[model samples]
Target chain A: DTAVSQTPKYLVTQMGNDKSIKCEQNLGHDTMYWYKQDSKKFLKIMFSYNNKELIINETVPNRFSPKSPDKAHLNLHINSLELGDSAVYFCASSRGVRSYEQYFGPGTRLTVT
Target chain B: AQSVTQPDIHITVSEGASLELRCNYSYGATPYLFWYVQSPGQGLQLLLKYFSGDTLVQGIKGFEAEFKRSQSSFNLRKPSVHWSDAAEYFCAVGPGSDMRFGAGTRLTVKP
Candidate 1:
């Protein structure tokens, strides 16, 4: 069983299209996060959810939104996708807010044409 | 602001040779340190973490890290490197909110 899993490991879409990446964590973690890794492999946190509540929101564009249905799921929805949004999106989860050990999924390689 | 620096962007070592990856962090307090390895086309795997107590912590896959408080460094070490050890290594340090990761060091294996 995967601890943290993201659907559609690879996404290919045209610009201006709207797409969503789903994520689920089997581990009973209270904190989940979304991270974006650019082509250069520079990973940065986009958003974080603690117990289904928005906690950390990095300086990201408004086009990207994160929704956590429950403590085990944190999905990312992108509106009006841009070429710059073509990157590997990763979903991660930790035991709690204070926990530093984060388990990441395989990652979703999104390609915007 | 907290930050992590991995000076060497890349490193090459022959099989069975010793390996060490340097990591330096800038933080106001005693930061939580971690070392992760990412294989090609895969997610990051936690090698080890140093929260408190022991300065030298052992991890899975025969990896270890030494936490030096004065130098603000947590360098990863392996006595004998394997060919499969060639991967991207990252160093991170943080707590409370988020962990800041280094640029990552790509390790290559030489025959």
Candidate 2:
């Protein structure tokens, strides 16, 4: 069984188009995270939710918003996608808020044309 | 601000040869160190993590890392390289609540 999973393995949309990526974790973890990996392969943490509560909100723009319906799910919604938004988005989860080890999903490749 | 640095952008090694990937970090306090691997079209997988202990941590896939406090370095080493092990490796550092990652090093194993 996949520990952390994200839907829409590949997403393609035009500029200004809004979209959402769904993520689910069966590991029963308390903390979930959203990360962005750019073309240069630099992974950056975007947002993190602990027990459905916003724990870490990086300096990401307001166009990006993360919603956690529960501790097992955290979805990312983009208001208006831009050309620069082309990258791989990864979903991860940890056993606890303070745990350093994280299990990541297969990642969703978002392409904004 | 906590940050990670992976000096080598790419590394090439021969199969059955030893390999080492360097990682350095700058943090104010005792930082949590981690090494993760990413295969083609796959998400990152945790190889090993150093929170607090003997500083030598063993991980899956025959990977291990040693954390040095004075040097502020955590390096990943393997006794022998396999062709399947050729992939991108990332070094990360966690300070308190936030975690930051390095740019990653791409390894190519030649047979």
Candidate 3:
């Protein structure tokens, strides 16, 4: 069984279109995070939710928004998608805010054309 | 702000050869350290983590790392590396809400 899983392992969309990537975790963790891996392979944190409450948020574009229905799910939505939006997005979860280990999902490869 | 640095962008080693990947960090206080591995098209997997005690921490896949507060380094080492070990390795520092990762070192195994 997958601890953390993201749907649409590959997403391809045209510029200016809107898209969303869904993420879920079965680890029964309280904290979840969203990360973007650029072409250079640099992993940057975009947002984090602890017990469905927004916690860590980096300097991401306004077009991107994260919604967590509960502790098990955190979805990412992008409005007015641009070419720069192409990258691999990862979802992760930990037992708590300062847990030692965080589990990661396979990641969704989002490509904007 | 906290930051991590992996000096070598890439490293190559032969099967059964010893391997060491250097990682340095800049944090204000004592830090929680971790080493993660990511294969092609895969997510990050925690190889090991250091919270407290035990300077030398052992991890899966025959990997181990030493935590040195003096040099602010947490270098991953393996006496013998296998071909399957070829992948990207990342060093992260954080016990708090914010965990920062280094640029990562890509390992290539030679035949």
**Taking chain A of candidate 2, what TM-score results?**
0.98
What is the C-alpha DockQ of each candidate?
0.68, 0.64, 0.68
Q: Which ten residues in a row have the lowest lDDT in candidate 3 chain A?
A: A94-103
Instruction: Give the residue spans of candidate 3 off by over 4 A.
Output: none
CAPRI-style grade of the A/B interface in model 3:
medium
lDDT of 1 by residue, B47-75 (tens): 99999998999999999999999999999
Q: Write the per-residue lDDT of candidate 2 for residues B8-105, one digit (tens) a residue.
A: 99999999999999999998888889999999999998899999979899999999999999999999999999999999999998842468899999
What RMSD, rounded to one decimal, does every model reach?
0.8, 1.1, 0.8
**Chain B alone vs. reference chain B, TM-score for every model:** 0.98, 0.97, 0.97
Question: Candidate 3: which pairs clash?
Answer: none
Whole-model lDDT values for every prediction: 0.93, 0.93, 0.93
Best by lDDT: 1
Docking class for candidate 2: medium
lDDT of 3 by residue, B15-90 (tens): 9999999999998878889999999989999999989899999999999999999999999999999999999999
